[model samples]
Target chain A: MMTKEQILQWLEQFADAIAQNKEYLTQLDAAIGDADHGINMDRGFQKVASQLPKLAEQDISSVLKTVSITLISSVGGASGPLYGTFFLRASTAVAGKQELSNEDLASLLQAGLDGVLQRGKAQLGDKTMIDALSPAVTAFTQAIGQGKTTSEAIQQATAAAEQGMQATIPMLAKKGRASYLGDRSIDHQDPGATSVYLMLKSLSEVLGMTSD
Target chain B: MKKLINQPEDFVRESLIGMAKAHSDLLKVQFEPTFVYRADAPVQGKVALISGGGSGHEPLHAGFVGRGMLDAACPGEVFTSPTPDQMLAAAKQVDGGAGILYIVKNYSGDVMNFEMATELARAEDLRVLSILIDDDVAVKDSLYTQGRRGVGTTVLAEKICGAAAEKGYDLADIADLCRRVNLNGRSMGVALTSCTVPAIMKPTFELDADEIEMGIGIHGEPGRERMTIKSADEITEMLAMSIFEDIVYTRTVREWDESKGGFVDVQLTNPEWEKGDRLLAFVNGMGGTPLAELYIVYRQLADLCAQQGWQIVRNLIGSYITSLDMQGCSITLLRLDDEMIRLWDAPVKTASWRWGS
Candidate 1:
């Protein structure tokens, strides 16, 4: 089971990761995009990080909802609505819960992925965040269905997310600003996918440490 | 990297503060969820027109918020799309009771955020409709890409549709007129130098002194191709030729459907330009280029039109829309019909554009 403290730690960890890799993400975006993905994501997550202290007493759902609102209001790009909707749906999937079971975590991941798919209208190979998010959700859900622990399932999810992020390097972009580049967009890893991979990896680390 | 900015984070707000101070008589700026609305807003029984996008394109959405134009304009960070909250707040501030029409440029962030704002506005029981302006011919394929990026034609559409709204056009009628304007307009741009977003503090891209980037958008993003720099005449020919030779471009667009209570896809095809068509020739500077250079481009553009048997009935030659000091220009050719001509020639009083009382 993933406790409420672990959920908070996961967000804090993800925000730190975004901060640490901010320039790296921007460099990746510079290759195919407008080169502000890192800056924009950092701006939103930094706000999210600042709000986490106040959210310490809230239920998981309320905390996630607050994060969603903060991101939607602060991020101000395609990432704003896309990531905001992800957290919004994830919050809905685990409404009123103080913690998450293996199945509940899988549902949260699946719901978040579904929200992104609907919000962004991107498919599996669109060279967007969906590329990393969809595969990670699938792997996590399958592992949970097979009766894996939350930590084990998230580890598999992180592995899948890494592979998915790598796979975006060779794909042609068909969404967002990168889509404007056409053939020139090839060979550049998608910055959105890279961030989503970091999110899953952060969750995995948090759950693994808690389990240990 | 050099810009007159106090802090990267305060760039948008400080600029907006200055704009509000300078144009206090024409428009009012609101903070928190930032938007600029006409000083005397909510003109009863008039369909309100609102438009917004990234903030770097000055005198665009914000500078145009005044009589006979947009009721409000939401400005996002340098090149980022404004949040939905900004749009929703703008709608609420200037609804005018006749309904609201959002003039959204066709960029992914702008599109999604305005879409969400539309839904939110509807939930609040305020009538809202959105029309997209996607006239940039730079993006060649609609099927494979996000369709064409909205560029110069957006300013034209705002002027025309803003007049229509002033003339008491209903929400649906104004929406249709906006769509019609978009269908008749086509644009292409070339960039001579890169621009730096204040937050980024570096040129978005690089080009040697002898090279120019073609088909660039307003946000400093690289365009279709880069090639060795050519003369003013040659560059004008290239840009004008690309727009002139563009075929009947078709794309599926989303607009709010009140009856369906959701968005419905509508397939729109731009009308083909024919010989002897009357055109509104716009030679626009990409911020850094001077007005004198734009006239040079206009000279060639007018000659090219004359050679093709098209008449340049009206022309707007200047940098009304720009990419924040990017050196270059874009050319927009809009075929004008009688109604559109009337709307285009109508009186407009905005901070950036003002003619006739």
Candidate 2:
């Protein structure tokens, strides 16, 4: 069971992952976006850092909700709203629960994607964060249905997210300013998808059953 | 990559200070808490007109701050919406006892934050009216993000509505005029090159040299289409045709008194060039396009207007507003009448703006 403490740790880790990969993300964004992907994601998670102490004692849902609001308000640009919506939906998915069950985790992940879609209005082929998130969510569902443990399902989801992120390199963007490039939008990596992959990567590394 | 700045973070503040220094006779920079206000603002008995958004969209919201445009404009970080705290401060400081009117673009954060500021001001018993400008005929309306965006047309809305306010129109009348301008104007943009935000340190998006993205948002959000780069005439035709279609299909200029007239017989006045009744033309730059290029576009548009049998009355040919360093321009026309022409000619002083002053 992932305790609320573990959840906090994961949030902190999420922030850390963004900080560590900030430059890489920005480099990718230089191609498809305004090159603020890493900067915004880093700034948003950093703000999420200050709230950690206050969030530590709260319910997991409450803590995540705070992160969502902070991100939406401070992160700015398109990424702020996208990541903000993700956490808000994640919080809703885990509502009234102290810790997530295996099924609960999958539902929460799916719910987060739903929030992303609701906010960004991006879809699978749009070459946005949805590309990474949708694939990850599908993988999680499939793995869990195959009787994989919670840890195993997360690993599968993480791999799928990474693959989905990779797949964005060749697809043309149909949403956002990047879409303005039309066919030229292809070949460059989607920054939102890259960040989503990082998010799933953290999940898999932190909670997956490595032994399995 | 070498920009005229000491530090990227301090760009907006330092630039505002320079603007205030250079145009102190017309513009005043509020220190400590930041914003750009007209030196003649808080006009005793008049309603305050406020508009602001992100910083990279320069000369907009700020360049329009003057006698006939904005009373005050709050600047936020690059391409980011200003906070409610900033908006509230502007709302309070610019209140002239009559009331305050907010001209907000139809972006998500801007709308939410401006709405919050309006609510907060209401708590203080200040009468505030707001008109959301959603004039871009690009993005489809959705339950999440607002439909279309406030784009080049914001300049026309601000100028026209600011004129109404200058005429001592009441808050309600000014609000109605603003809404009317919003209804009348439509804009579409094409980007030849992507612009880079200083903080972001890279182009907002990628656009190949050989192609152009049509229907792009000022935020550098992905556009709807990418087509082969076309000639100035072809591009002008596409953009102007889109705007005309929006005006016609939206029925923005339908005859109010069908019994009195067929189509609205409008007359353009305050002619920038002595000519017959054509229309008001604005050949605006998308930040990086040169004035010479813009004039070339103006020539094409003037030809277009001549071809349409529309007399070119008043024409503004320059970058009145910009979208960072994107290399392109937009064509905007306000089909005006006698009153609008008088209002357009009204003297106004502001940062990077002076008309009949």
Candidate 3:
């Protein structure tokens, strides 16, 4: 069973990854965007870390919402709302659960995607964060259906997210500000997809999931 | 890049101080570590209007805060949206019981932050309504596309809407008016060069000297298409015609309709026209472009407008709004009727914008 404490720790780890990789992500954005993707995401995650202690006693859903709201409010750019809505929807979906079952994880992932679709209205193949998230969710759901352990399924999902993130490098952007670049948006790695990879990698570790 | 800023992080802060120093005659500065509001906004009977976004889009959502435009503007870090708490404090300082109107640009961060501000303001029993401006022609079916971004049209819309509010239009009216202006306006932009974001210390995008990007947003985001430089008239034709398609103009007119505020769907379909439509056109500079080039571009745009039978009631050609040192320009056309013309002529003043003396 995954506890609320673990999830919060996972968020911190994800934040740390962003801080460590800030220069890399901003380098990617420098080719196509405003070049603050890493900085903004790092600031938001740091803010989340500061608030995590105050949210320790709260329910997992509430804690997640706090994270969502803080990120959405602090981070500027499309990433803020996209990530914010992801956590908000995920927390709302997993509300009232003290411990999440293997199946509960799938529902949480689904909630996050739904929120992204609602806020970003970005469809699959739009070369957005959805590209990585949808495939990862599918990988997890399929593995769960195969009767694998939750840890194994999440491990599969994390791998899938990493692959999806890498896949964004060659795809042409069809959503957000990058869409305006048309063909030029191609060949550049998506910063959002990169962050999703970081988030999922953190999740795989905290859940102690080593195999699919 | 030879700006007088102390550090990259301190540009917005120092600019706020400069605005206070430069315009002490028109407004007071509130640098409570976040946003700046009008020194006299509270006394202005009409509802307080507020708008903000990432900082690099200079003279926007901030410089336009004064008499007839936004009462206050919250400036975030470079290319970052202000936090909700900052907005909440601004709302309290500017709200005078009449209400508050948030003229939010349709960027994702701006929308979310403004929404949070609305909720926080409501928690304090302040009446707040937000009207999102999505005048960029780049995004389509805005409800379906990644959503329309508020672009050059914001300056024009805010000033006109500001006049209406100053004339005692209520919150609901202000909200609808904001929507109306956004609906009627359409804009397309181009970039001749990329800009360097100070914090990141790199060019936002790479562009060849001869390449010009179409559909460029105010932030240094790449444009819809990159092409070799062409004649000014040819470029103006492309932009003006693109804007013409998005404007849903109609010939249907109501005789002396008092309730509808005298609005008509003025079409710009025919290219071979003597009178296109009454238009408020803007030849907006993209930061590094000079006033002389802007005026020259305006010259071509004016001829194009006339060739299309479009009557130009108002034309603002300058860098009232801009990206940070990006060499480029945009065109905005607001199809107008009698009321719009009257509002266009309304006297207004703000730090970065002014009309009718």
Point to the candidate with the largest TM-score: 1
Higher-lDDT candidate among 1 and 3?
1
- Candidate 3 per-residue C-alpha lDDT over B59-118 given as tens digits, one digit per residue, 9 for 90 to 100: 887778877777888888787777677788888888877788888776666766676677
Docking class of 3: acceptable
What is the lDDT for B320 in model 1?
80
Candidate order (DockQ) = 1, 3, 2
Q: Can you write out model 2's per-residue Cα lDDT over B3-83, one digit (the tens) per residue?
A: 667778787888888888788877788854467887876888888899988888888887788888888998867776765
**Least accurate stretch of 10 residues (summed lDDT) in model 3 chain B?**
B249-258
List runs of model 2 lying over 4 Å from the truth.
A27-33, A50-62, A89-127, A134-149, A160-175, A179-189, A209-212, B20-48, B81-149, B166-176, B188-194, B200-278, B337-339
Give the CAPRI class of candidate 1.
medium
Local error of candidate 3 at B317, Å?
1.7
For candidate 2 chain A, the 10 contiguous residues with the lowest summed lDDT are: A203-212
Stretches of candidate 1 exceeding 4 Å from the true structure? none
State the lDDT of candidate 2 residue by residue for A1-212, as single tens digits.
46687677777888899999998998786666556678778878998987899887789899889998788666666677677778889899999999887788888888989987865656787888899999999999999899988788888998999999999999977665466455667898898899999988887767853343
Model 3 bad stretches (over 4 Å): A51-62, A92-99, A145-147, A167-172, A209-212, B1-3, B21-33, B119-125, B138-144, B231-234, B244-276, B355-357
lDDT of model 2 at position A147: 93
